[model samples]
Target: MTKADVTGNNHTLEVRDTEQTMAQEKPTLTYFARRGLGEMPRLILVESGIEWTDNRVDTIDDLKASGKLPYGQVPLLEYPDGFSISQSGAIVRHIARQHGLYGKNDKEAAEADMVFDGANDLRLHSRATIGNDTLREKFISEVLPKWLGFFEAHLKKNGSSYFVGHDITFADIAVYNTFYNMQILIPAAKLEGFPLCQKHFESIASRPRIAEYLKSRPYTAT
Candidate 1:
């Protein structure tokens, strides 16, 4: 079969029929050795059952030396045919769309985007307070509850365990990953006020593929 080429963000992608053959070489994902922004995309890839290479570089020096990255950023997803895509959220959306895990329709997709954006905002806010003990404490005591309460309300409105539609979506994965990182960063912080969100996290975590991947990797906040 002929291969099609698609480009994104100044990068080229060789689009071959995904059903070509199971023996076809898997794509490669390059990132720092830590979970950080790459974790959600990795989770999507793993849960989709797509075979991919996890290329972990330990240092920025090593990454620059490789000359394979487009933006010199970690979490770059590269195809076997030399095409690659950068940016964590984009990579996660690409994989989710490819695997039919993005959403069911336009409305669902929009809802998913809403949840993803909200989760990302929370993640950024939490990360900004990382090294400062006082800021982190204040964030946990005040800011965290507001965001968690918002998520809890959204989950209740959706009337399902997933953030969008009845099935798992990238939004659920995104929020879950953020929550997972928050727990890692602040072990004492509890989700008691957000029971629905807590259950939602557990639901995503218990997925067969996700559960296996979670067990295989070491605990990391980044």
Candidate 2:
């Protein structure tokens, strides 16, 4: 995408808004953000050609009184009227299923979930180090290599650019978002030698929808 096409204070929040705005006039997904997993479902909303609203939930009071349906955990999904659905993977799969990001069939969707689940593992591991540089380094230097390497080998064996079959799926999006988002927070050099992982990250991450989103808003922690 052209640089002029993207405009925002930062790539992070802008991407969130980009996808959040994408969920058009359909089932309307109300999401709770943990700054990571929630992003996948949000991407589905944006990619689905739907326009929806974003509501920030800060305090527990804010969460409960905001009138969202019960979510055992976030990122939660709420219907237009406020019925809530919990579980990050579930929210993501639901949105993907609704928007066709899950894939063409059940088996395809399951494959998508496989990729997505791997991405989630990486993200949760990354989150363990919130602001601890030492821990973050350990995650990126040690843990991430194993994870990214595994996926890269899998993708190579599959003989495709994406994580799933030929088409894009929530799995691809999840891995891309998690990997790229981590890069935003961590140095790429830390992931050196893992070329396939790095390549897949750059490719899936460069989508117009996503790049445009990044060029607009570069940072959003929560």
Candidate 3:
């Protein structure tokens, strides 16, 4: 096995000999070397414990030139059997469904979807504040609190470490990703007054596989 570091981004890719691992046929996720929309899917892949290729790239020219991207975008998930999908949300859900990280029943699945959407809403708002100090201040002071309050109440109602059912789901990882990105953007942001949210974040972070991925994942600003 060899790890290839992507140029300009310093992102690492875990490579294995094709002759040795061809039978397993590992999946590959192609995306820019950033923890933006790609992060949650990557997290789900790691948590699933399936050896996959983290195919990070500095540009999508090759992919676009190849016309393989359905929407001409990154974050494309491709299986060895020619099954491929685009869009981050769908990719995350598909992987979750395949690995039992999705909720068990239809109702539980709906609940998980709801939580995932809500977390995505927060993520979008937070992302908009990236370079604008005015928006950033407003987001930190007003927007974040509102979203955190919702998550706090949601977790309190669930009465468990997970967001949907008894076990961890994609929704739990989505929430964790949102909080993780927020902390990356604002180092001083705290979950004060939202104990459930705090505990939830810590709980997800401490999961065995997740902890390992967090420790070794390539550093990114967002």
Candidate 4:
């Protein structure tokens, strides 16, 4: 299906019953209304050209009350067969592998793993500081630089816009989402010296599918 067919302005999927379409069942991603950990996986799905469902929960209480989540957490991936997977990292990796975005070979996959883990580290730190203005400021001033600098160095070493080799991998998406969420949390935070990191984020965000998804989806701070 075309990007327009899968994700129109309303951000809703059109159900189809063709044999091929039915065989390739659309997965459903359950997450909070905010982007949070689910955004990257959503981006992966979009970039991979998969048409899926976005099941957003209005509140944590509502999610807990549902009692269908395997781990009582948002960002759960549920398949058509009623199987579900939890944890943001696992879900991202799963989708990446399914979509051939994990990496090209063993060496590239290892590099991708390193970059993805590093991005997750930064994400954890940023999430922990949310809602605390003082802590958030300190993170933006001190911690963010360390992580962003590491990413900048890696991007420079890679000698390309992507995090791993010539193509965009899960690591690239992870890093982009990390920076994207950081901007949401700390809008004033700037990539003063990290031109590569800035470019990396923009590159992923500007992908045709990713850009359309961003434009269609509602803004939600996490």
Q: What is the number of backbone collisions in each predicted candidate, taken in the order shown?
A: 1, 14, 0, 0
Q: Which of the two, 1 or 2, has more lDDT? A: 1
Best by TM-score: 3
Deviation from truth (RMSD, Å), model 4: 7.4
Against the reference, the lDDT scores of all candidates come to 0.83, 0.68, 0.87, 0.84
Evaluated against the true structure, the overall lDDT of model 4 is 0.84
Using Cα atoms with residue i matched to residue i, what is each candidate's TM-score against the true structure?
0.86, 0.73, 0.87, 0.83
Q: Pick the lDDT winner.
A: 3
lDDT of predicted model 2: 0.68
TM-score between model 1 and native:
0.86
| 46-141 per-residue lDDT for model 2 (tens digits) | 666555544435444555676553653456666654455767677777777777787788788778778777877887787777788888878866
| Regions of model 1 farther than 4 Å from truth | 1-20, 60-67, 219-221
What lDDT does candidate 1 reach at residue 169?
A: 89
The candidate with the higher lDDT, 2 or 4, is 4
Residues 153-213, candidate 1, lDDT per residue (tens digit)?
Answer: 8889889888887998899998998898888887766788688988998988999999998
Q: What TM value does model 4 have? A: 0.83
Candidate ordering by TM-score (highest first): 3, 1, 4, 2
lDDT of 3 by residue, 1-222 (tens): 224433333232223345346545678999998988899999999888888999989999989999899999979999888889999999999999989998999999999999999999988888888788998888879988999999988888888788886999999999999998888887656688898899999999999999999999898776
Candidate 3: clashing pairs of residues = none
Which residue pairs in candidate 4 collide?
none
